[model samples]
Target: MRRTFCGSMIALAAMASPLSAESYPDVVSTSHYVPVRDGTRLAMSVYRPAVNTKAIEKPLPVIFVFTPYRGRSKDADGKVTETAMSDNLGLRSLLRAGYVVAVADIRGKGASFGHRRGFQDRTEALDGRDLVEWLAKQPYSDGSVGMVGCSYLGGAAFQVATTAPPSLKAAFIGASDLDKYAFVRNGGITAQFNTRPDEKPEVDLATVPMDEDRDGSMLKAAVAEHAENTPMGPLWYGMPYRDSMSAFTGTKFWEEVGPYTYLDTVKRAGIATYFWGNWRDEPTSQVILSAANLGSRFLAGPGSHCVPPEGFDLPGEIVHFFDHYLKHQDPDYGKLPRATYWVEGLNGTGGYVTSSELPGVRSHPLPWFLSQAGFGAQTSGAQGASTFTVDYDLPPAEYFAFWPRPMTEHGLGFAGGALQHDLKLVGYPVAQLKVSSDNPNADVFVYLDRIRADGTSEVISFGRLKLSHHKLSLAPYETLGLPWHSGFEKDVERPAAGEEVSLSIAMTPVSLVVPAGDRLRFVVAGADPRQRNLTDIKLDPAPRITVVWGGQDGSRVDLPLAN
Candidate 1:
């Protein structure tokens, strides 16, 4: 049976700095067509703060966002709203602080002309550069620009920042991936979320027409042109290898489309970059820590994807960041810590921790050895192995969850001793397992869960690896001191039947404080319904997985404990 669950991204203001509705200035918004060098007319919406019902004439720093999701959409009642604009958490806050906000539909998605050649097309980056230069020259703009976005819009910000536009001064990215390939095909397994076959746009959704195009004549034309646009799903599914060439573009699409491939360009530009990420958001938190040494500031929160923890003034942080870089105000700006991450289970729900050095800088590895008597801090001398039959019928723990799935029921579970004191896990956890499978290939999933003294338990973090993609390599970019598997075509090493091999799987990065008397549980599984759907990985005729323990080839997990 199939099931589905839904969750919403939520944020609560830590401090209220409400702009009285009566005293708030009016916002005057207008839409126009900005032509790129390729003559594609990108639809842009410009909003300027007003003084006493009159649009301001003075120049101000512009905050720009380019998104594939409709930039400006109109509802049936003729009510219009900016899509993905709430990523800032406080849009009016930026405007009230003397900043002009601009939102544009990336080519082909909304009321923008031209087909998207590929996912996050390189051409779009050039278009971003052109838009930045154009916005800088606008009468209301102060020749300085900053970009703010989450997810895809964040990708756009990174892509555009790589172009190094002179007018671009700073950027704030949230819940975005550093490696596009790693994100879409995470851990060398295809992600099911963005790779659904031949998806279509929602019927009720409508793009807001540009000024003077109330009849939507131009909007219709733009929609018509979008029919020729390429779908990203097939492209993502087709490219299993990082070096795989896209049949559509006849180029290594992953490299061309990835912002990390051109990370040096962004570093050279020296844009004041700030990233906000969530611990529960797989890969995004990993990316933030990977880029920590790039001279970028980041806030690693203890929330799910795009969700912020309570009592954290996320909007206030954004305002402060922009105020420091864009306005050159705030005397205590540069003194802020380079990295700030939320530690879960602290002070009840959580609290923030700041570090002058990058995350995991002062962390030391705490290795736990696995055995039949459950895991222990000391290594076992006995040779033992556990075997479990693969059950494809069983659903993943927390099946159909929009949040992180729980450990599988059929998984082999081993528990460590109850903690004598509160143990803080602050970074990536690496699982080194020696295993043999009856099948030529198997998918390995490792979950780290916490079992409370009262018997309540929760999954902390999990990781998966397609056995065929287990070969390690030197990473092109920083990997937060975790093991790096290239997932390149050349590195694939599939095990033969009954062959034993060692796999170093890097679990997703997380920050949590396991309280005293709570025991840590490590679960390993050969099958996960969600991951199987993503990769359609084939199982053996009668799959029986064996995990070797004790001695030199024993399975173990190295946890990053903060000093």
Candidate 2:
């Protein structure tokens, strides 16, 4: 018989049964360590509803989550309690949804044995397979298993599934760390939050927290210390790549940290996947949707990285995928879109729309030449003041904050307006320009904004580049509708002084509506001071950057308008 869902995920969040331990009379919560091939045992917590008898009436599917933080920390009362979920995104709703659930601490973290490696080290997939196999052998499990999580947990999910674990059936990944090297390290400037290397676990897992009482204090102290060391708010952005790599990379090699580095390999894993996350999320959900055409579904949210489970219908979606893949139910995958994204701003904005691909986007690239009279998106005219040399006063960090909707609005750089018409844009916008620097090396930040006649401004899109690494990869530009930087290594081309260099910088992908009567604006800043500690880096040539157009040198921005 097909199982009937209790209610919508919205109702599930409001339900009291899973919220309190008193209501979960038949649910069993157990904690233990799961062994891996390396003799490392990961601390694991399992929650399953019990049948009257020792064995369940029928085998059940399992949902496993891998977390970096210690979920269960002992309190002063000596009671082992789940702190992560209970305090963060609780798994109670999943337990109430009638599924066996398991949460494990990645090896070398949270009372688990061994040294914690870099994020999502490829080897964790092996342990993931072992965990899935272990779950399959459990009394209540029927062999089918799925994975789930957001952010770091999502990365773990992606890492394990890419390993092609035998018993793994599906995954629900939210705000996963994919394609971040492009967005995170945009234009050679460090973007978004990077990891804190100094915040290593104070309590050594090698010691093995033997006594629950003693270890609880040690674990609590370690967690507290780690939390203190980790920066909060909008603290990290716009440093050199070396600092980012150094902090994000731990004791292990850097290659293992970014799963996107092996983009092709991960996409080939063949697991039924649901890629869902907020569009405004630092890494951007669009990256996952557009990069691979796999057997997957995309559910994009309009919020930021910290979108709550209920806000994004997280519980409902997870149940839907797990129900179909793990429980063998026929959930309708046909009605799903190649991409379903949300658009904010302007008339009747802020609701999801389905699409064959990125919604309201096409190959209609319209050029807007830079002119003194504003942007000629419809007509081209040379700006009498077209050539503006690098002011050098612009900060490098302001170029990197490309999130929280409408992109980052730091007000750094040059300004121009596309007047008299509303520009509805979706997808990546390309900025091409002929630039020359007084110094041998220069960094440029280009930003686009929406200026309603009232004078209020909101950033629409932005792009950046280091003049040295200006070689564009035509392959990605052809397919993805934006330029792919060849990186600062092999593609380094430092322009000779006063010798103009052509550059095409790709902005972070976006979906927005510029309402009628609003105008489009563009800005160019030599460097953005808004980035974290970019002033420390000895930027070359002292910023005398020049943007020239029309007279011998042409510069323009191609806005991808929804046609």
Candidate 3:
């Protein structure tokens, strides 16, 4: 059986109240076809607070959301409908706070008329700027606009913010990837998930017809144009290196589309941004910390992907953030620190700790050495090594589960003695391994686990690196002293067979607490069965990997531990 832990944030999350019909009233909604600069039309759905079936005419701040997912659509009966609650990007919370909300579709998706030259094309970002300025000019808008979304929609806002639209005063970004190059091809390995393109609807059900497309003629034309839209799946697999160019875009496609490439200009725009992410989500927290100089606020919850933690009102927090930045209202958001991150295995206000500076800076490094006897705080005098054979037929690990089964049990395992006291781990960790492989190139997977007093163990964090792309260097941006691996072609070098190479692999950032009796365990393997070997290399004869440790220059892991 697996154990589950949870922390409560009811008091903090209760700052914003739940929506009530009497307090918020009904919302009046309308559909429109907004035109971009290139004569392409984008679909927008507008919702405003109403009284007695009539929309309020008073100007109010607008909450803007732009996404590739169908923002608005017309049913078979020709009735316009907004996206459902889960996909609306906190529409209810924004509306409950008495603000106008507008959601728009990207150029080539969801009833918008245009063709996508590439994934997250620059053209779509320009369209976002045009739409923001247009929304500010609307009669119901107070000339103030803010963007909100998670995942793809959150990424859209980041791209548009790079354009620096004057009316885009602030934004609420959640679980977004600022660096596409790092996201899709992390550590020089292409993720199987990113290699797949977004699913499309059939011609008859492509998207909803805009308000002006009475006979569905315009909608038909838009669907026809989508046929020429470039598929990102091929481009993802085709561009193996960070600097690889795409013939379709005729540029470094990944860097061009990534918002991180335009950080300087984005800083000049001075958008009061609020980033939200979970430790188990995409490395949005890393992006938030990297941009600490942007004078932004962030919330790093302890959850998976876009899901919020238990008893934490996620929508309520969004409302509080917008109330201060968008409506100029005096909400407690201004009274808090710049960052609030959740510490696992804790409860109440203590779990959600705040700090003026970004996370990872205040912690000290604690080194744990690995040897044939297992893990220990002190290094061993005698030199020794552990070896494991690459299992081509190993079972693939489940990707989306909250707790992974013990796949590393079949691999090389090391364990430390039970902790005498509670151990608190904070920030990023670096695994320094002296490894040698029979094959010229091998993918290394490291798993961090905690062994309970009951003898059961659970995974805490994991990291992977392709040996060929293990070259380290100073990051182009701020990483707060973390190791950076540049996956450029020039930096690529394979280790000679059986040659010992020292690798400092950076694991995922984490905040964890292990009880007094819990022991720390490290598992090292050749490849993760779930992840595809994007290197296009083979291990036909089943290569053996040996991990060298002990003596003066032994293998160890440096963890950031809070004092």
Candidate 4:
């Protein structure tokens, strides 16, 4: 029998579900701790339609999500004294679509027991599997289960899906990193600047007291214990730990369960997966790697780390995907692969279009070699062009701020005001350069931007490469194909005084239609102050950069040609 439901009806149900008074869906509305391996009890919440006495009796497929946030209701004083389920828009959509939705607090947060651990940790996967197994046996569940979430939660979904429990069927992972080292550390270069190492562990934030005098000491002690233990130990310990005790027992968990270290093993598990990400999301590219490795479907859009209407039709698309895969109603589900990208315009007005694949267009290699007079192509061999000594002692370049700051007192201004350029690129662009540095190792920062006729320029995309780790391995390279996988791995050792070397740096994918008068510019530098300020790292003899051209050394840029 076919059942019909309206979006309006779902919205109304979400409002009255006791999850929230907000206009969006508020499906899940309470929390409880579910016990897992080693006596660890994890917190979880369930959101579904209010029982309709007149409704049909068939069971509904279940959608389970596990996040670090607290699942509890708050009082007028902004204090959370009672357990309440999450009320996210995505869950509401799932419930309205007639599915039972469940949200779990992975071990070590909210009402869940155990220590706080990060994504892809074995404990997380175990708890996830246990949760699905438990849910499948429940009367509310239709015996089928799927997982969904973004960022850390998305990563958790990826890990749990690989477990392939009998009841677990599919997953929707967005803005997640399959290769933890590359995505989080950027080739071992950590973003220690942005992340506060001392931040409190992931716990029931609502239950935390605002008055430090009351809760400060307990919070401090908890954080200190988490920091001291670190989650990586149990992960690498393997065997008894892997099969027995919970793997999540502390913070700094990423240090232990490196995603890249176990991707091959995980892929062999063969769980049906739906990988989603955004162009702007730093780690999103990793999803592509997962798709290619597991031969799963990949869906990408334009946005940052989080999914939304703020992004492309992520919530709706996820619902449809889960419906088809988990519910098994649509045989032709998610069979299409469209690379939908947004193009930024000169006037700040842009739209999105879908292409068959990345690097939609093919273009001839355009060589822009480095010379004493800036960048140019080589006409002949070693003798034809001027050879300047490469050193890192060049004047320090300031970071490029994407948005204007309240104080103009900072940052380096672009030459000739903002060099505005409009670009109508259709494919991938690669930058190849040749040169030997006095130092064997150095990081290259490649920035792509659109400059307007007026003095304003916005960075379109960028890519980085660590020179020494250039020996590409097929297995590791496959991981790099993922959107979230940043290829930079290890620092290149300092080069012999005059030995020359060639390097290939990948540029970020960009699809845009610039106004006729705008300009597309590429800036090659050592550090990007806007995104990352390397003011702290001291360089010896400062690395010198030399752009190699086809005729000069074997340097060239490969652009994906338009179909």
Candidate 5:
């Protein structure tokens, strides 16, 4: 027999009035202590309709959510006045349309008791599946469950769905990462900017109790390493990974953790999954790539992080999705379409345009070849068959000497130099370069800029490669029609210390409509200031930088030809 804890009055008071309290089902708050396979205790709170006492009734469908945030209620002063309610008010909207909602803390976070490791997708899936199994046995539960959330929670939802737990039905994963290293690490380079220096105030991992001896040791080591290794190292990677994975501990948790890694799991399980993302997002391309490859239903809209229901009509759409899957009312849900994207720069408001496929929006790859005329004003057309020498033994001054002052002031220079060109770009862009270097091995940095008429320039897109990992992956090509990975760790074949190599670099996607009369400039150099001290570690002895051509044929820039 398992011990179960019911919600206190505080929990009930926290969710007293859902937005649509007057109509539909009445919400009754309840709580429970769900036990993981390892005997670790997890906390869960429920929000469902108050049952009609007069008649015997069947069980109700439940939506189980797992989060690291506390599930306690709040007071008037915003203090912990009561047990937190489920943070997914978006999913609560579904409950108002009549479904039970269950919110739980993973193994070590919130009110749960256990060790918290980082990025443990496997444990989370087991917890999710076990919780569903437990719910099915409950008199009030109809034995059918679905999952929903953004970020880490979204990953957990997908993980649980992949298990094909009999009670698990569908999932809506928002702002998720399918490939751990690619999405967050970016070719072994951590996404330094997205993380805040301070720990999340919502949950305190330091005080969270550990369940096993190994858990305690791992947690202690991770903390010490993070504090010792400041500017760079394995510590940086371990900190974030531990913080995210510590909640769940299992193999399924790790394997199905990334957005890309879990795709096959979901497809094989025949789970109905929907992925959500926003345009202008740092990992926009990654999300698009995942959707295109997985054949999962995707929604890309305008916004930075998660698109709120009010701004992007997400609430209404989510309700429909849940209705179609949970209720089985819409047989055409999965067959409706492959992709639905929101195109920027339409209707004068930069609104959304739906598409059936990722390529429906037509990405024009334009190239702005480098020339010797200096920065943005160089319009010498194609200087085909020209060559430049790159010496890697020099210092930074020779390569980044003229980095514009505006960049330093705005912190853009840290990433790459900005070219003073004025041009409003309306599509994707790529660069092709023919190069010769004094050193056989060298890293190439390319920065794309939009130069204004007033001589001011802003860095728009950038990318990097070691020249050696140029060979594309055939796995994604064979299965999904896309490249899965860029083997950055592989060393480039030596160039005989003074040999030339023709190279083509792919940049991140940019959808800005550069203003007319503005010039588009390409800056190829040996170093990036922002990523300084990060990966692309400062070349100990600097390197020489030079430009060779500027034309459609010769080092060209590809741009999407818009309608």
Candidate 6:
């Protein structure tokens, strides 16, 4: 059913010969604006091999990328504040590989013009199809086109792939969120990361400066909604529950976001895709969703949301993948399995495995019981139940500071005992807790941490659940250690003061190798201002809470192990 390989640049490089810049001619960069069907134009920056790079007599496959986040920007006075790819995506390497690399700003950002919609805008999808068709018709194009981008750019790539554009050949994406609901509000709880703009502080404006003939029309309107939708923008992420929830409740986010992972629609599209996921970055679960829906080749590595591979040639890997798919070349690259991942805690052990499935295992469900004595993950036996108070009315204190501190430091929290032995937690974790509350609903925050003999602790994963929305939902076709909530259709009821109900909380997927001696701790509380990012989001106000740990029969955490 699967194949496995250890992750290493040396292994990936063996699939194909990396392109050498010395063997190619100089590159020529071109900036232009092409009109879409609506008469609006998109700004594209293209890098092509000069005559010296041995441009074949025929057209070549094109790598098209469209992003809302500006890779290029200009100051207020038409000054060139940034060129492009300042983040070092290694675009030049692709140019040397004999592929045309084009980066564009979706309708609203960069040098393009139009009313930019928030996250996954469908109009951008249409714009992407138009761009792909336009590039295919170009004299330089060999009629095939592929798209690449990470994070926001990856979001753009998904937009294009879902359009089912015939000119689009393949997509190489990284760190993108396809499902708006699951991505923005996991299990009906909002994400804190959306509140602020990513740290692209190199330029203040979203639009890059371009020549009058090359850039599109009124660019200021592009940033208008962006400014209103970004950092401190209450409706999307920052203080989401405050005014934005009620204000934008009726808005259709799916329409603006178009088709993405976690939906059946994306599965129908025909596109060869190569994706990348970081164990510590983005939503690792989404990677599983895409691999499941699209049947993609996914590679796992270290890096935050924006980074590619370190020490290895990410661009070179991209070139080999493109050549195999777009050029129809038969190389060992196609022989590799669909997935590859790095092993955690294996210092120089060179632990990398390749398989047909994503990193999370589907076989084992290890439950660590919650007890009165401690957060008992020992698996030996459960103590009694634990009780904690929840005061939604407790005059909000400094919630920001609480996010960075360990759960033990949270004054209103409870922590379980450490692990009984050295454990390796390799996938997303789920907390199946039996809880009761005085109020009709409650907001439960669950956290996972690793503790060493030296007492230094590192938080590995976190999960959130809203009591009213705690009804069980199982996904038959998907798994990454936890089942997805059926949805928030019918709110569940609380246990009339004395009775308790089961709450299955799904934490973000994670990879960790705990030393045989290091222990894992579980933390639970009413609210965590920052589930994953820095923010001041509180619980939905509950007066008191109780966690039932009926010894072996009671509550426990089921952790997915690497083995």
Give per-model TM-scores.
0.91, 0.79, 0.89, 0.72, 0.70, 0.82
Local accuracy of candidate 4 as per-residue lDDT tens digits, 1-563: 11223334443212222222222222334344567767766656665544332232357788888776554434558664322222233566566566777777656554455675544577778788899998898777889988888776777787777566788878877767765555444533443222322234544443342222263454344333444334442332221211123344543344345455555545565456766666565655566666655666666555655645343555566666776777665565545554455654414676665555533334334444433333333332342222333223334333322221211112111121222333355434566656555555665555555566774766665666555544443444453332222232233344565566655655655555656555545555554443332454536556665544335354444443332
lDDT per residue (tens digit) for residues 121-188 in model 3:
68888999999999999999999999987777877888899999999988888777766876677777
Give the distance in Å from residue 105's predicted Cα in candidate 3 to where it truly belongs: 1.6
**Model 3 TM-score on a 0 to 1 scale:** 0.89
Off by over 4 Å in 2: 1-26, 50-57, 73-90, 195-197, 200-269, 289-295, 309-312, 360-363, 383-421, 474-479, 551-553
Candidate 1 per-residue lDDT over residues 170-228, each given as its tens digit:
99887777777777776677744455444354321388778857687888888778878
Report the lDDT tens digits of candidate 5 across residue range 7-105. Answer: 232122112222222223335555556687788667677666442311114466677777755554333455642222332335545555566677777
Candidate with best TM-score: 1
lDDT scores for all predictions?
0.75, 0.59, 0.74, 0.52, 0.52, 0.62
Poorest 10 consecutive residues by lDDT, candidate 2: 1-10
Lowest-lDDT window of 10 residues in candidate 5?
408-417
Write candidate 2's Cα lDDT for 521-540 as tens digits.
67776655544545555365
Ordered list by TM-score, greatest first: 1, 3, 6, 2, 4, 5
lDDT of 6 by residue, 1-563 (tens): 11111112111221223533222334555666789989977777766655543344457778887876664665667765322223234455555566777788777566576655555556678899999999999998999999887777777888778877888888888877656556666666664545443433234244644445434334454444344333223445522221122234345543346244324544554578877877666465676666666777877775556566554557667777787788776467667788877666755333566786676654366776666555555563644666777533333334222123356555233455555555666677888887777765566777777777788986677777777667766553454435566443444444465557778877777665666656677777775545444234443444477777755567778887767
What TM-score, to 2 decimals, does candidate 1 have? Answer: 0.91
Model 1 clash pairs? none
Candidate 1, poorest ten consecutive residues by summed lDDT: 1-10
Q: Ten-residue segment with the worst summed lDDT in candidate 4?
A: 405-414
Residue-level error in angstroms, candidate 2, position 160: 1.6
RMSD of each: 5.5, 6.4, 6.1, 8.0, 8.3, 7.0
In candidate 5, clashing pairs total 55
Clashes of each: 0, 16, 1, 46, 55, 15
